[model samples]
Target: MLHTNHAKHRMPVVTAVRLAAMYEDDRMLRSIRDLAPRPEEPLSVGEVIAQTPIGTKVPVTLFPTVGINRPGTDRWPVLIQGLEEIAHWVRTQAVPRLITGTEPPEPGLPMRYEISVGHEDERQAMSAGSTTSAGERHKKALAAASARGDLAEMISMIDGSPSEPQIARWLAQLNHEEVLERMSPLRMAFDYDPEVERHNFEVLKGCRDAALRFGDSDGPHEK
Candidate 1:
């Protein structure tokens, strides 16, 4: 009777061991490409074997466990290197495959579905809001630069070094105190969004004011 009960306990233990082994195998077989490689070392053996096939996220998970597998060649292989290398190999191989009548792989369904469902109005609103926020930040940055007598640096940071022609035009606009009119020509000429043009004009005007304040040196110029 003791032996009979002992057999029953042994059976469950055996089953549990088998299940644990199977789970370990599955874990070992998973694709680790997306997982960051351990720092301070080249690729590891586990990573080499855990690579997925080209153009697919599905893991290969099985290899001969011996011999070198040169990637992107007619030879035994289990995996390759980084995604960029894989992409390059695919592009290199694609033309020949297409010439022989193989269809190119399309993007996965989820990406296509997301693109199809994109909300244009929401995107436009988001872009507009971002532009507005950037403009406000630019003005504040320009003011700070002006106070420090470094308007040129702020102007360069805003966009880039303005051309001589551009500086002359901005100077005329600033002298006329016509910031809105300046924005119109700059927007059209530079192909900038209206908000960006307005922001740039304000930055220019701030620089001119800063220059005048520095030149006067008698006192702050009357507004």
Candidate 2:
């Protein structure tokens, strides 16, 4: 399903601008001690990092609003490049986790969810439905509806019920994931990241094999 939740809770415009400003102006990052919510109180660099929308998938337009205040005509590209550098740093350095004091879940715990990409609405559902049966049901319903509409459209074209272009324009006006969604008249039926998951699985398997070979001594470590 498409994930749309992020659209509603987008990072605030001011926060995006400030973070973009920090990236565009080295002096701002260097003089981080001066950042504050008000005139008298000083905010630490870590605090700023916590407040910044590190993981937010905000719109690109926010960058231009921040860049217009700066000196050069080339500010947009420079800001983009700088933001990329910062994102790289955030991922590798684990800066977001450090500042937020959040940690990865214990590997022993059951796999709660899997990462998949979809449209905005689907994304929203995935986030809200995490580890919940009801969420899964909703997802399936949406998928089934979408499939039905697709099958219906294909059948209509094959049967010569209407011109393809006419059907397409009608479908567009319905403005839904599947024409059935808004029209309600149609009916129908219908990688894992190997580098990370596969690598982890292999390591675990190797450890298990070695523990079995060593018996009691190495078995405890496997646990």
Candidate 3:
């Protein structure tokens, strides 16, 4: 399922970029009510580990308009590497949980929604420890998403920090295949023409090449 998801990954990006273009299309659309509302003040980032309805699934007909600035995810995302993972999680766990009412889901792919309402200088890495910010991996992955030109650059511009090198490496760690799975439809609408299927197809391959370059960038013979 993951392999097939990877194979068909390009469409998601094309669709994502298409989504990125929405605000640019009609500034008036911002007033829509049913869509996730932009908060007057920033919302909290909940820790789903303890309280989120891990595997609950709801049938969604429309793509929920998310992050006001980024137009991506509203909730802190469930990091999935493929479409099939989502399906499996929803079908096996979420549905059963819905039926049983008391059955809780085992975490990971199935666990997405964070129940706790929860961040500024605390926002950037948004992770904390007994001392200063000491979060690892996934935070770095989030940073990489914010730094990449093909992505966060178009949605909400972010400046680089000491975390730059780590995020780049983390983004590289994503490998090309995993990237397509993680993306919020990358803002290709601002750049690529969605009408041309081949162009969209090639762009993802180009992303793969860039991933190779990141891997090489750290080598003694950096390409």
Candidate 4:
């Protein structure tokens, strides 16, 4: 069915249809989520309704269709505005990343550098720039590595050799860049495997050095 928002914005037909379907699904899911079968605990809804489907690569915290039953809380429109950017990243950043094999595989790391389909899910982190906080600083470094199209450098940042301050500095110094390049990082990543999961970001480039200084024997070393 044609939606007003769809016509107004002229979004991709498939995307618009998918978005519309969520509203319909949300209407139903929220109803079940509200049901409290136990009469004794009516105030407390025992049912848990997940906002996202299982195995989603999107952010787990925010649901575009969340609060569909409540007015002024829908975020689908927010996502709609960002669809182009998201699409661009998937096509340019994520797709190229997936197709291109990780080069110069790090010593003692996974020797299997050949990418299997569906592992290059880190759209947000790789596209991040240094503006927000320490977290963003790290992602910005990864994003810089990604822009250079160097997967090995990305691994180095996560595993060994502190990524220079120059990368983020260079991005900030740029007088002109693509709109996509300047957009704030969306904070997402691949969860297809534990080795490549977003949580691996926890141990960044400087972590090992800091650990060595602090004498934490458990810190991850070069691999």
Which ranges of candidate 1 are over 4 A from the true structure? 1-191, 218-223
**For model 1, the run of ten residues with the poorest summed lDDT:** 14-23
In terms of lDDT, the best-performing candidate is: 3
lDDT (0 to 1) per candidate: 0.37, 0.37, 0.39, 0.35
Per-residue C-alpha lDDT of model 4 across residues 1-223, encoded as one tens digit per residue? 1223434455332221111221333233333345432221111244443455678644322222211111122223323334434444444455556666543221212112334444455443334322233334445565555544332234345544433343333333332232124322222342356654544454333333442343334343332
Q: What's the ranking of the predictions by TM-score, best on top?
A: 3, 4, 2, 1
Residue 174 displacement in candidate 4 (angstroms): 2.3
Superior by TM-score: candidate 2 or candidate 3 = 3
Residue 181 CA error for candidate 2 (Å)? 9.3
Listed in order, each prediction's TM-score against the native is 0.17, 0.18, 0.21, 0.19
lDDT over C-alpha atoms for residue 208 of model 4 = 31
Task: Give me the overall lDDT of model 4.
Answer: 0.35
Candidate 1 on 13-82: residue-level lDDT in tens? 2110010011223344334353343222223444543344588565232212222223222332222222
**Tens-digit lDDT track for model 3 on 1-223?**
2223443454443112111121222333424353443332223455121232669643323222222221233332222323335455565566778877856543322223322444334332222322211123445556555546453222122322213343355465664436545453443343346665455445444544554455457564322
**Where is the poorest 10-residue window by lDDT in model 3?**
14-23
